[model samples]
Target: MLISALLVLHVIVAIVIIVAVLLQQGQGANAGAAFGAGSSGTVFGARGAASFLSRLTAVLAAVFMLNSTALAWIAARDVGEPGSLLERIEPVPQLQEELVPEDEEDENERDEDELDLPPPDSH
Candidate 1:
């Protein structure tokens, strides 16, 4: 359960990192401002958005790595346990084999049949 929760959180953080990276303007974006693209008077000031997004991306990436490590450790730890998902559940009654009586085929005949060899000649 803990590992599952961590996996979900890891995925969310990874998505946030992707979005954060996409939101940040590239270095070349500033070059457009120099030619009158109007980079001034922005929402997060001149440099605030870049720094904040970069920091957020870094923190989330670290979380993603830590979560991945934790998940790997948990999976490895569970490997030695006796019961996995299938073992925990009881099998349906209908799937079980039923005992049936067979006709009296002697031991020697059973053995010869099992060996699948031809019978010996009676010289």
Candidate 2:
């Protein structure tokens, strides 16, 4: 339960960080300022979004790192092991027997049956 919740949180934080990084303007955005375009029609004007988005990305990254450490610890500890993987699987003696018959007579009989097939009639 705890692991599942942490995993969900980790994914959400990752997505949010990606969005935040994308939303922040790059250095090339300043080219528009040379033409007096300014930072109008933008969500947080020129400089405001940069700081806010960077802070959000930073916090989300910290959360992601902590969650990753927790998940790694859980895997290392091997919790909730009702049984080992090999022990949980049931033996398949019947399948093995069907796949490989024990008697030499069975193989000979099968070969004979295949050879006894009627020849196809040509049109």
Candidate 3:
């Protein structure tokens, strides 16, 4: 449950990071301002939106990385717990069979009989 919540948060942060990066202006975008784009070009005056978005992207990236690490840690820690399909499956323990000399001879004969097979071309 905690992991699920964390995963959702991580996804949200990743999306926000994408949005934040997209919102920022490119390096050459400011070159136009030198030509005559005017001092009132941006709503933030100069570098307000870019600085804010870049900082936001950086913070969200850190959050995404931390959440990923947490999810991995939880999955590894709960590897043996009964939740997932692999975890729910309990391995069947092998039983020790006592063998006698007489039993061994009969078992060997049965094993040889089981191993007897026709060639693949016989099919």
Task: Give me the candidate number with maximum TM-score.
Answer: 3
Quote each prediction's TM-score.
0.51, 0.50, 0.52
Q: Which candidate, 1 or 3, has the higher lDDT? A: 3
Model 3, CA-based lDDT: 0.78
Decreasing TM-score order of the candidates: 3, 1, 2
Runs in model 3 deviating more than 4 A are 32-50, 81-123
Off by over 4 Å in 1: 33-50, 81-123
Reference-based lDDT, residue 49, model 2: 46
Better of 2 and 3 by lDDT: 3
lDDT of 3 by residue, 1-123 (tens): 898899899889888988988988776667666666756465434655447778888888899999999999998998765476876677999999976767447544565557868768854
lDDT of 2 by residue, 1-123 (tens): 988998899899889989999997775656665565775544334544447778888998999999999999988798676778998788886643445545645544565557877889998
Could you tell me the lDDT of residue 31 within candidate 2? 65
Maximum-lDDT candidate:
3
Candidate 3: lDDT of 21?
88
lDDT of 1 by residue, 20-115 (tens): 999987766666555567666553336654488888988888888988999999988888657678887887778667655566545465653478
Candidate 3: RMSD to truth: 13.0
